[model samples]
Target: MPPLLRLVQQQGVIMSERKEGQSIEEIYADAVHWHVNTGGETIHAKRMGGRFRSLKWWTGSLWLLFFLSPYARWEGHQAILFDIPHRQFHFFSLTIWPQDIWMLSLVLILLAMTLFGVTAVAGRVWCGYFCFQTVWTDWFTWLEDKIEGNPIQRRKLDAAPWDARKIRLKLFKHSLWLLIAILTGVTFAGYFTDIYRLWVDYLTLQAPLVAWVVLAAFIFGTYVFAGFMREQVCFWLCPYARIQGVMVDKDTILPTYDAKRGEPRGKSRGGDEARGDCVDCKLCVAVCPTGVDIREGMQEGCITCGMCIDACDSVMEKVGRPKGLIRYMSEKEMLGERLPPLYRRPRVIVYSAIFLLSVSGILYGLTHIPPVELSVVHERQPLFMQMSDGSIQNKYTFKAVNKTPEDLRLRLSVSGVPGLQLLAADGDTVTLKSGKTIPFHVFLRARRTQLKQANTPVRFRLQGIDKPEISLEYESVFIGPSKA
Candidate 1:
């Protein structure tokens, strides 16, 4: 072989070997790294105390309000009740009827905007702190801790065979969980009906089938999702988790490991010799509720709960090192770039604008809710009738709904052209039932000389006799013969 050709072949072989070595190194590194969590194994995360841990406990306890809110009473009625059968929502002194359902749309918009704004600012704070899955799982795990001890002991119990002592403990824990599940179901159903009356109906086996179905669904869902599924629900079931990536940007702050400072990690000994602060204790992974090794970089399982930060900080304290080995930071900040204020962030600004608009619409809807609603239909069979006295008459069916809580005596009147007279309604008083629409035929008569066109604009006004504040006006066209 020629010397140049041989040298070229040798260089190619060396480069190929280097590429092969790189591939092997990557596979070995991945093997050493803790990757994503699958639902196959039960995660037994260690519990520890720190600022974030305390915050989690406090936020989790806020869910107790959901279980207790149904029992609250005001003015001899459920304070916050959704009377679905009556199509009413009562909140203390305020009543919302189906007519006011637009407010509900605004409310939903407000909630969505708030979620978007918060997600854009801090990633998944709602999931970390206030989500039903997180809160219920926390409660279930706390109960487990009380009954079966910490993560280590819980793992042992899981591995243990069905002995008498194990069976007793397991039975006790399950019984408690079942009770909680039942209570959660009942409380959810209580919101739609009177809580005390529902209890009576349930005990008597007279509750509606729909209510029973809802209770059963809630019970099963709570037991399975909170008690068993736990983090798996966040991983595979929650649609919010899937879409949160789009909502969060690089500016969004999240619980993250400082890779620049912590890489090339080694166990911290008394003597420092070119090593990062990480002691390689694995305490962060041990305390992670989702079994995430945050130091490996952010993963889908990281809920940004800051639990790892708490765990690492406690370990740092114990090892007499400065805290915040794992901390909440934005990508920009982590890359040594300046972060703009929240208002300057485009996502935050847009979300805030939408939130404000939704809130304003809701406020306007609530404040401008009319006391009465009116609809008028002009009779089409015979547009106008010729009276025996040579007068032209028009007939209309008026529907007036009294939205107030009391029955009202309404005085009906019409105004349009000169010489217009109202007939059929005697003494000008029409009775209206509370929350009911009353339909009645009304006739309007006018002299033939008063008719000016084929159709003339007319107004109908209703004034409440008992409560003058309850009034409404509607405009309609009155049909008449065209002038010759």
Candidate 2:
């Protein structure tokens, strides 16, 4: 059976256990009422102060880099630019051409491995902490809470008639949302163009149509998705939530409710012996961004944000009970089983191996990016032309792309074919234009007696005249008449 199915079965048996001789059915007779929210109404999740809340704020602040990085300068150029028109990706001093695009595959693999490894260790921490949608939605809602009111007051205001006060608050909130959305779009586009000029063009309303389109799309998406959709986007729109079920196992640590200690829950009426630690406050559900109940077991709506843990811990403190009714724990730990180390888990081992390999490949590619890319194409229409001197002559084209900022003075030579002679540009030096691919035609002649076969192996070597450290080679065939 699939691991996911087996995990579900094990959790089901755990949840079905009897408490203090009471039957499984009797234990759930007073279970907390829970229902799935299907977008009928907006969930105004109450915010509170806690360790995880502080961690969320710290993680969300990382997005400030996205807005600020485009303005960074390097070597009199925009640093970390994806210059699509020039077909080059510039990262500080390194320039990547189309030929080195294979590095992108390694980058993607590295990201995938990281995601899988993190998911195997902990559940959906990326979604809760670092996802753009989560962070933006948090910002939008925090603004709403400050401008409108707390969750209760906000809900009441939504139901109340539209007054002048209501209109003013709504307008101010949406205007701020639109401003953030516009900045996000513009900053993203700035990575491809000059940000200083882009800002000027946007302010003057002289930006290009593509820029305007990008700005408009981001404005709509950010305003609607972050401001209105909120957790519904994570529940219904984000594909990651759906696939995360397979990534988690019994050992994965997640925000879990300690049902064994918290069952038979009731309001504390001065040392009620029959009741468990739970006070039945329902504060956990109120603070949950996705409106999920921790006692109801893990659900697809859970992003594992740990807001419920904070709420439950705070409530336990108020009632003079021990904290941690809900906390980060694995099913194995909850079931009184020994938790295995990360290295012992097969899933973690495989993901780590792939992650390291991708990192190694990416490092190799970055360190070995060539200063010049060379290609030699032998003319194949006539294969070879016979000279009046009964010599075999071959025509070839040399295409060299100089990736450097300045022009290169390069010298070309031929080898591999015996008695080969290069008759190009009077056998003088060649100039390669900076950051451009230029083609040069050349002729190669070898005595017919020197040619051993119809296709003779040849190597074209290009060495930089000004920088003697630069050397590049291309292998091709010197076509000639077949020897009988």
Candidate 3:
């Protein structure tokens, strides 16, 4: 049978012949009219109240932390700052330096695994609920709805001539959008510098050129991407949409139309028992933010937001039919196959393992961060010198980095060889400047007769004079002449 005839049969109504010399091609074309939005015109999605809509709003509110977190203070400084110029990251009482940047790799891995795992299981819930693009577009549209009115009125206003009322609404909406864009830019820039001073500089127009450039870029991106592009970004720009097919499988549950129950769609009339449950109301298409026709099947534009599910359920209730004409259902369920447990899925298992390992590594690195770093470089040129007193001397350079918040007076000593002595000074001490690496020279002498080998393992110890509990050690090789 032809595709249109098969579709009709699936709807429980099969027509043996076309109407009045109509060809199969014409019949199929008329029956299946799948429309895709290509950004030629604007889409004014109708807003509806439902459980998923409420959930979307709740999740989007989490972005408020982005605007408000920079102002939070901890110990006379911003609570969380990247401090890129100083090569430090501060979070509350803890600080991370360049030497500990490996933790950042683990953090990135954790985030990637989380995204993959969620996509494999739920199918783009992040894009629907928590993505910055989705949240900002929702916000912009909400404001548009409040200022202009419903979708019908907004469309009319756009089509209306340049009248005073239309101009006022457009100007007001754009001004509010620009304000949000500016705030977004400033808040982002505040993460790398002192937010209060940054705000003052921006207000006075005295900020550095780099700061101005960053602000301008962010403002332009936010205003254009969130306000004008809307769902077009998800359709044409997002790489995630292109790769989602590989991430999801038959077991993945998504907002799906029940063809078995909703086929042969027609309006229920007086004593018409042959019609299916769907009333051909098209409520699902009206409420979709992306203008996806769920009845046509899952499309690239579907974000799995579940808005159509809510709309379909509402229509089903109003028409005295069962709910869930559209719902989150996997292909296996549609085909009467049982879905395996999440742990049994290969991708989920791998993703969960990587996610756990990355979290563990990050925690271990953060908790085990050292308070000081030390390295010793033995002098290569003239590694050993014969002193006039018939003693052998060796030169070494010590580089110590103080990671503490305060300077320290450190007493230094050497061990590992008998009859060794400090040629520079006995019981000597050096000062370590806070948050800096300073290099200094140390000389050690040993009696010639005490030399047992050409190379000897030596340990250098640094003890804090004021805080005796602070001790650090570095092991180095002391070079000398061959035993004779």
The TM-score leader among the candidates is 2
- For residue 146, what is the lDDT in candidate 1? 89
Per-residue lDDT of model 2, residues 1-484, tens digit only:
4332333344442344445776544444433245678888899999998888888999999999999988999999988799998899998888999999999999999998899999999999999999999999999999999999999999998998999999999999999999999888899889989999999999999999998998888889988999989888998899888888889888899998776677667777456686678788989999999889877677778888888888899998998878998999998987889879999999999999999999999999999989998888889787899999999999998888999999999888889877899999747588988888979999999999988888889998888899989999899999888787
What are the candidates' C-alpha RMSDs? 6.8, 2.9, 3.8
* Overall local distance difference test of candidate 3: 0.85
Question: In order, what lDDT does every prediction score?
Answer: 0.83, 0.86, 0.85
TM-score of candidate 2 to 2 decimals: 0.93
lDDT ranking of the models: 2, 3, 1
- What are the per-residue Cα lDDT tens digits for candidate 3 across 327-350? 988767766789889999999999
Ranking by TM-score: 2, 1, 3
TM-score of 3: 0.90
Sequence-dependent TM-score of model 1 = 0.91
Q: What is the lDDT of residue 26 in candidate 2?
A: 47
What residue runs in model 2 are displaced by over 4 Å at the alpha carbon? 1-33, 425-427
TM-score of each: 0.91, 0.93, 0.90
Point out the higher-scoring one by lDDT: 2 or 3. Answer: 2
What would the per-residue lDDT of candidate 1 be over residues 1-484, giving only the tens digit for each residue?
3322232232221222234446543433443356667788998788788898899889988988998899999877799999888788888767788888988988998999899999988898899898999888988888898899999899899999999989998999889889899899999999999999999988999999998999999989999999999999999999999989889876888887775566446786658656667888999999888998877666678888888999999888998878887998876777778878997999999989989999999888878878777889999989999889988899999887777677888898889978899986565789888777769899999888887888989998899788887778889878888786
